[model samples]
Target chain A: MLIRELERLENLLQPWREFEYINREVFRTLSPVQVEFPLVNLWKNEDKVVVTTEMPGVESEGVEINVTGKTITLRFERKPEELKDGEAYTRRERRYGEFKRTIELPFNVQSDKVEAKFSKGILYIELPRAEAEKPRKITVKSE
Target chain B: MAETVKDKNRENRKIYAPAVDIIETTNNILLFADMPGVNEKTVDVTVEKNLLTIHGMIEPTIDDKLTLVFSEYGSGDYQRVFSLTDEIDKNNIKATVRNGVLKLVLPKTEKIKTRKIEVSGEA
Candidate 1:
């Protein structure tokens, strides 16, 4: 459909392309997750804010997530694999090291009501709007 | 097997080129591919005529009930091909898929394997 084509065009211009998955990101002098944004998809409805992030190789044991009302922080580390005694490295593209990022949400959400799920290397987090923060319907007055 | 080849030939559908990491070890060459939504039951790794192909069948929707408000990845099948040479032992290659990471170990052929020379004691 035309919509799908448009979306793909948009994706091509996104910063994700800057990383290029391989080749370029590997050449960066910095180590893992430095100055990088995990592919994130965010949306909001009347009652909740939902965020999904793609993290292929990160494991639960090494990952840490924290929430503070309007912000979320993720931190993790992946150790580098050492080369074998006689083997030589032909290509070095994958990167490994410590990664940490804090993201600010558009609106304040209930910290206690945040629910997270990890499936298929994607992390989904849902935060419900606080009772006080929910918009109340105003009755229209007629003259 | 038939389904995989069909999928490979599937046209007009989105296909994602999976990100890859290649590492060489003393005894083997390892490849790591970031291919989420693919499991052992659905992954296909094949070698034919010196061409190595990796295909991962992915589900279209994770949960149909949950409305997709936005998306960064238009999630689709993962496909990539690599050229293999005599240095690799195609018959003995091993692969494992866990938590969306595909680990492939290609054992080096005997000819390229580095063997330590036996040192003789001084007579």
Candidate 2:
């Protein structure tokens, strides 16, 4: 119970720390900066692992994927969308910036045979299971 | 696993509000919506009685065979509405959906007439 309370307090303190950091940076450079990361989903089975991420406004050329051992790293750079001169914006919710996401796999995967596909703003990656990670059945010797 | 069993009504899928950016220019307005799981065939944009609505359907996430390891974003249909004003030329508006992003270009005014001027002193 005490650990949970501490965690709650930490979560509440994070925003204030970020606010202070932003203010300090704003004083140094008369400009503001913001960043956002896309959401990710992972699904795994006996033979393969599938990873999906939502990355709207990211061009196909701006995505980079690297797999080393049981971890995968994704980097994205999306161009900031702009409006013409004299235009007014009514509502703005989507954000544009550069971000990176790295996640460890549940198990070791075959890095050489990994495949990635991008469609409709979603990035789908399929990683085959390593031979050692695949399930094996053992036979018993008869007495 | 618990999220699916709690709601058995398949037709009552949750409606999500898609992230969008609305920008205006002197001659037109541009709307960009993030709908990553939707394709052109699955998206519908309609304007009725000055009410503009955008709808996109995404595949359900509940699967019997595949086991979920980790998830961050919710999966469902996206629906959003905006009121149109007289400044917009609805007839010339065009929209395109690619890679789950929808871009709608709303022109500011109607077509302008071109007048041919001839000078008497011109050869």
lDDT of 2 by residue, A1-143 (tens): 00001222332455643464466457657745443267888999899888889998788788999998899999988876765556667767787777899999988998999999887898989998999989999999999
Please list the C-alpha lDDT of all candidates, in the order they appear: 0.71, 0.76
Q: Tens digit of lDDT per residue, candidate 2, span B7-112? A: 5553566566677887766566788889988888989998776667888988753355668899877677877767777767778879999778899988865442
- The Cα error of candidate 2 at residue A95, in Å, is 1.4
Q: Which parts of model 1 have CA positions greater than 4 angstroms off? A: A1-35, A137-143, B1-11, B60-74
TM-score list, all predictions? 0.75, 0.75
Two-chain DockQ for each candidate model: 0.29, 0.30
Model 1 chain A: which ten-residue window has the lowest total lDDT?
Answer: A1-10
Candidate 2 C-alpha error for residue A68, in Å: 1.0
Clash count per candidate? 0, 4
Off by over 4 Å in 2: A1-36, B1-10, B60-64, B110-123
The candidate that wins on TM-score is 2
Q: List each model's interface RMSD.
A: 9.3, 11.5
Q: What's the true lDDT of residue A111 in model 1?
A: 88
Highest DockQ against the true fold, candidate: 2
